[model samples]
Target chain A: GGIITQTPKFLIGQEGQKLTLKCQQNFNHDTMYWYRQDSGKGLRLIYYSITENDLQKGDLSEGYDASREKKSSFSLTVTSAQKNEMAVFLCASSIGLANSDYTFGSGTRLLVI
Target chain B: LAKTTQPPSMEAYEGQEVNVSCSHTNIATSEYIYWYRQVPHQGPQFIIQGYKDYVVNEVASLFISADRKLSTLSLPWVSLRDAAVYYCIVTDRTGGLSGKLTFGEGTQVTVIS
Candidate 1:
């Protein structure tokens, strides 16, 4: 069984600071995605990578940048953290098929002070 | 991407059956319905996906209507650990990053002892 590992399970950043979240998947999937979930709300897609070095912006891509450094690694960067901004960032991967199932990481909880 | 609607919350007791319904009035013929659940402080986990008719897996059973406008996820013998938010999403045949899966506020299911 493969696992999606997210680094720094908890993050605290100052207002206007830049933050980066990293994800690693052993599934060797061809597609990776980053999603943000606010407290008491559903998740919103931030960005996704279809292959290495390929990036696609989702509905919530503003203020965020993504990097598909390799096939198994995808990173998300917050350009400028807002004060009191708190959310959980989730990483997921899939085989890039028409019926491939998605695997998700535990998540990175971010809190901006 | 087809919009989905689910209940805000539902309550159930241990060993009881829990059925959550989702409505997608404008679902396309090529679209598929998917279910996912999220526990506290964790990322969403995929449960099941189906194009039409009924589909079952060890974790849950999905029943889709003839018109594909409605689908239900049935969880048998609920337990406390099953308490979480359940999401229903509809996406096209092109899965992965190209599918553009959108997650709306899902149903919060509380399984009590």
Candidate 2:
């Protein structure tokens, strides 16, 4: 079994501040993704990486940046935190191109004041 | 990507079977149905996926209709741990970073004693 670890489970930031969340996976997966979950709304994809250093933007990519520093790690940065953007950010990884092999991290809950 | 619709919430008792249904009226022939669940304060967890017919694993069973416009996830003998938001997603066969999922509000299954 492998684990996807997300650092600093809770994050608090002021409006207009820049915040970054980190994710690391030991599954040796080939694809990684970042998703934001609002209270009533479901998850929306922010960004994803096919491999190390390869990035792809999703429907909700604006105001957010992602980097796959290495095959085992992917990071997401909020360019400017806003109260409306405060939500739980989830990191997930899948083996190769298979969707059924997706494994997720605990998540980073962000709170912007 | 095919849009999905699910119930806003559902209630089930412990040891009872729970069947969550999803509708995708415009699902393409090349798309597949996927199921995921999210417990409070945690990332969404992939439960199952199917192309057509029926697919079953240790955790759940997926039943897809003939037209592939509808699917159901059946969990037998559900417990309190099963209480969570269940998501159904539809997407094409393409994988990698290009195959990001679009999630809906999902069905919140509350398992009561």
Candidate 3:
């Protein structure tokens, strides 16, 4: 009965350029997450927020920055795009970890040249 | 985060039941097994999850062994739309607030007519 919306279905950036992806969830979930998926690979966590103004670093948060300015929105910024990089970034939200009630948004496909 | 292992690929025919197994030899006591599917150009969708024994939902069923070391997700009456990459994950669900999801190389399931 809820939906997560991600902006910019496709992104094209130049090498060393800064790119950003945004996500909005109307599920009123308490936790939000960002994951990146490379070709033929699994999803990797980038960052997460348990509540508004709370940020946590994930395994692959090195070159990324995240913000939870509002409970309904979470944003991810790529510090510097790598050349020839292509990947899909997903946004997900959940009420709690107790059950697997996680919901995801259509991902943003990023391509750097 | 307990690591998960699943087949790289699988195939099934329409109207057939497809079962994908996952192995988590070192799963912890408080961990849970979750299954998600990702259609091309879409975000991953939650299918089912189980802590122990068997759990069923409208879309799929999750079966866990007594030892909790292995689990299976069964999707009945498969169709062409069922073709996608399936991911099995193990995570701690204590306090109803698990951190981020750790994904592995999922199983690419192909449903043929």
For the candidates in turn, chain A alone yields TM-scores of 0.97, 0.94, 0.96
Instruction: Write the residue-wise lDDT of candidate 3 on A32-113 in tens digits.
Output: 9999999988888899888899898888999999999999999999999999999999999989645456799999999999
Clashes of 2: 0
Residue B31, candidate 1: alpha-carbon lDDT: 83
How high a TM-score does candidate 3 get?
0.95
DockQ of 1: 0.65
Higher-ranked by TM-score: 1 or 2: 1
Q: Candidate 3 — which residues are off by over 4 angstroms?
A: A97-99, B95-99
Residue-level lDDT of model 1, residues A1-113, one tens digit each, is 88899998999999999999999999889988899998899889999888999998888999999999899999999999999999999999888846436788999999999
Residue A3 alpha-carbon offset, candidate 2, angstroms: 0.5
Stretches off by above 4 angstroms in model 2 are A83-85, A98-100, B96-98
Worst 10 residues of 1 chain A by lDDT: A94-103
Alpha-carbon local distance difference test for all models: 0.91, 0.89, 0.89
Q: State the lDDT at A58 in candidate 3.
A: 84
After the best TM-score superposition of candidate 1, give how far the Cα of residue A19 lies from its true spot, in angstroms.
0.8
Best by lDDT: 1
Ranked candidates, highest TM-score first: 1, 3, 2
* Model 1 stretches astray by more than 4 angstroms: A97-100, B95-98
